[model samples]
Target: MPDNREARAAARTDMIMRTTLALAQETGYAKLSIEAVAARAGVGKHTIYRRWPSKGLLFLDSLLSLNEPALDYPDTGDVMADLRRQIYAAVDLLTGPQWGPLYQALVGEAQHDPAVAAGLGERFIRPQTDKTVARLRAAQEQGQVAPGFDLDLAMSILSGPLYFRFLISQEPLTRDYVDRVLDALFAGMGPRGPADAPASA
Candidate 1:
């Protein structure tokens, strides 16, 4: 009986999250509400409230549940290649129709709401940044990256431009742009040899 109860709870949670995403996709985040989610999910408002404290958090959880797998970093031993692959996959997901607008809405909300901003940093940004740093550490161990390089700074440098284009400049995030960023990053961060030494003036 206990096992059955747990299974039922899990199923209901899954259904509620999926319903939330579907409604957000159709009506957008600005129009999404707990009442709508509860009605569409066939659950009491209290049920969603018990699971999530706010609409922003509920939407954040739903977005991560659906899209986290696609954003995972690869470990192909070639750090640059792996980073390239993972970043391209991320760009595709972020710019795609399913979650892009929803994420944009969340980011907009985060600007005005401290709770949403904190949740975004803690739940999404920090985890992704940690994963990136881990990958860079692995490359450092393998001598692909400089021993003394700041992995955290490298992560920011790598992601900063993309976010700038994504959120600020509103420019297209193309593969060429990704390649250029990687090229520039690796040029400075990759293992250096005598040939890489700067020429005397």
Candidate 2:
């Protein structure tokens, strides 16, 4: 039930997205360009421009297209257990063979480019953190977390260490690491004594 032009357009879009991601993974952000993408996709620069205004937009779109089905926000009631699952899934996605370099490239580019930073934060990072925060809020309501616990901080506590290991430490992000991160976050977010504080390790 699809029109000829629409079908062709969809196919072309798929071709362009795949080519864009392939080039991004191969050459990284600095060398990637609309011309290169169009050339690799066997399309015209004008064709790409008609769909996306800038190479950055195309880059973000390509990442989002690939990211759509991977990370599902969890809310299965048991706060620590759910967070563990979510964090492990995130670590897997970010440190996995196919997506790891691409994720690192996008995040690294975001550090240098304001547009990329905004795009990645607004499109990718914010949504993920928001989902995590929502999950925390639910846990707070259920009395699993402290009343004054900061959802934003909780999100950072959960995700920050993974990204640190992933991007900064350049170390292996493993299941054990995820477990430790969750353990530390739980200790911090759970009911604490007067002398309690978040564990950095």
Candidate 3:
């Protein structure tokens, strides 16, 4: 009986999240409301409220559920290749008609709402950052990356420009842009040679 209850709850939550995404895609974040989602999902608004404290968090979870598979890092032993593949996949998603605008709206909302910002960081940003740092650390351990630089900072450096272009500057974000960023990052982070070392400074 307990197992059955849990299954039903999980099914309901999935339905709610899917409904949220569908509504957000159709009506957009600015116009979407918990009441609408509750009505569409055939659940009480309290059910969503119990799961997610705010609309921002609910939307965040919904987007994550849909995009997690595409955003996951691939471990192919070639760190640069793996990173490139994952980043390209992200670019595709971020540039897609459905997710791109919704994510942009969420980011805008998070700017003024601390709860949303915190939720975004805790639920989405940190996990991605941790995965990136882990991958970089693995490369460092395998001698593919130079030692002594902070992997956490390295992860930020890798992602910073992309976000800047995507969200801030509103510049073109393309695979070529990703490749250039990777080229610069790897050139600096790759194992240094004696000749490449700094002379007496």
Note the Cα lDDT for every prediction shown. Answer: 0.89, 0.83, 0.89
- With a 3 Å backbone cut-off (N, CA, C), the pairs that clash in candidate 3 are none
TM-score, per-candidate, Cα-based: 0.86, 0.86, 0.85
lDDT preference between candidates 2 and 3, better one: 3
CA displacement after TM-score superposition, residue 186 of candidate 2 (Å): 1.7
- Pick out the ten consecutive residues of candidate 1 with the lowest summed lDDT: 63-72
Q: What is model 3's C-alpha RMSD?
A: 2.4
lDDT of 1: 0.89
Ranking by lDDT: 1, 3, 2
Descending-TM-score candidate ranking: 1, 2, 3
Candidate 2 lDDT tens digits, 1-201: 999999999999989998999898788767999999998899999999998888777888888886674565667789888877887788877777778888788788777778888988888888887788888898999989999988888887777788888899998999998888888888777866566766679
lDDT of 1 by residue, 1-201 (tens): 569889999999999889989998898889999999999989999999998999988888888776674567889999999999989988887888886788888898888878889988988899889999999999999999988999999999999999999888999988899999999999989998888889999
Screening candidate 1 with a backbone cut-off below 3 angstroms (N, C-alpha, C), the clashing residue pairs are none
| Global local distance difference test of model 2 | 0.83
Score residue 61 of candidate 3 by CA lDDT.
83
lDDT of 3 by residue, 1-201 (tens): 569889999899899999999999998899999999999999999989998988888988888776674467888899999999989988888888987888888788889888888877887788888889998999899888999878987898899999999899999899999999999999889998899978996
Top candidate, metric lDDT:
1
Task: Please give the distance, in angstroms, between residue 129's alpha carbon in candidate 1 and its true position after superposition.
Answer: 1.4
Off by over 4 Å in 3: 1-8
